[model samples]
Target: MVDKGGYRMASGEAIEKVYYDGQKATKALQALENIWVKRDLILREPKELNLSRPSNREAVMMTIVGTAAPTECKSCTKKDGPFDGCFVVPGVARGSCNNCHWNSEGIKCSFRPPSANVDDTPAPRKPTTTALFKKKAAATAMTATAAQDATTTPAQAVTMTPAPAAANVTVGNFEVLPLILPPSMTNAQKRLLIQTFQNMIIVLENSLTDMV
Candidate 1:
């Protein structure tokens, strides 16, 4: 069953007892605060004090208990949901009050006070097989589409002419020269050396052509 704050406490005699005690304590503290504020016994401060400080112990305790109590809307008698750590006082009661809406005549009676500031509690998480299956199916579909795209597109095939055995041997000989060269040559020097080698090769080819 729901406690005074409309929260369903754990089922047990011990829990019920604690809840009842908390409700009574909450009521008493609220009464005291109401009296103090009305009679000007406690003066409102310019700045709010930290609740954890010893000097503000009584005030803090009063605020906590008073705010924790479940308060029903005057109109709907429904317990207001906790917001910002504070309990809200419901709007004035009305005969036309429905489950979703409030019907109040006056502005003051229609509006709720600001909620108290409180610590945030984490929400519970639930596991579902349907969600897991959907995720897996989506991932599988994407993978299949990518595989199909890869197969449909042909790769650029490189063709190489088979050279004579002696010509193949010459290509391997030049490949070794780059490894044997000094590593410190600048880019300009390397380019010049390449051009010189190309000119020498052309001259040798022309001389061979003339002999043929």
Candidate 2:
């Protein structure tokens, strides 16, 4: 029907406007057919890989290791089968896989390849400064202990290390120590000697200061 502004319109809303994409449907059918062909090829040929059939939830993203990298291909996607057997377009490569689309540079068929399964184990984390210090300290301690063990004999295997002397015990400024005299000396003799020693000490200190 024709609209007022010279634009074209379809029939009334009652006539269900069924839009069909013929090209899209054709492409989809072709893809399905290709998949069937690949599947048939797989079934017909001997099973090379012992992969457990994946469920819808755990659909594994298998990688093609034999090729340089199949992900780089335009036609194939990650959803494509990761079958061990080669599934190339027959016209392009039938006998020789070198002519296949999957070929990247100059790589060849599978001797042994791995899957692209998700690894459950966590990746090793980089060490922080604190962790690194702890490791270094532990290593040093271990090495020292090992060296000590190697050098030490049964008789000299001491666990507790002896403490070192801190300060020298000498006379400080103007400090008087106890008068430790012999028992044979009388108190009167001790008093006289002490008085004489005090005089000598004063004289020596004065002379030293003058020399300085």
Specify the highest-TM-score model's number: 2
Residues 62-90, model 1: lDDT tens digits:
22332222433353243222211222222
Q: For model 2, how does the per-residue alpha-carbon lDDT over 1-212 read when each residue is reduced to its tens digit?
A: 22332222222211111112222222222332333211111211232322222111011111111223433332222222332233333222211232122222112223111231123234699999999999999999999989889877868886744443222212326645555565666778777766776777777778889999
Give TM-scores for every candidate, taking all chains together and pairing residue i with residue i.
Answer: 0.21, 0.22
Q: After TM-score superposition, what is the CA distance of residue 81 in candidate 2 from its true location, in Å?
A: 5.2
What does candidate 1 score on TM? 0.21
Residue 52's lDDT within candidate 1 is: 35
> What TM value does model 2 have?
0.22
Residue ranges of candidate 1 with Cα displaced over 4 Å: 1-64, 67-125, 150-212
Clashes of 1: 6
lDDT of 1: 0.34
Q: How many clashes in each candidate?
A: 6, 0
After superposition, candidate 2 runs with Cα above 4 Å error: 1-125, 154-156, 159-212
Which 10 consecutive positions of candidate 1 have the poorest summed lDDT? 92-101
Question: Whole-model Cα lDDT per candidate?
Answer: 0.34, 0.35
RMSD of 2: 19.2
After the best TM-score superposition of candidate 1, give how far the Cα of residue 210 lies from its true spot, in angstroms.
46
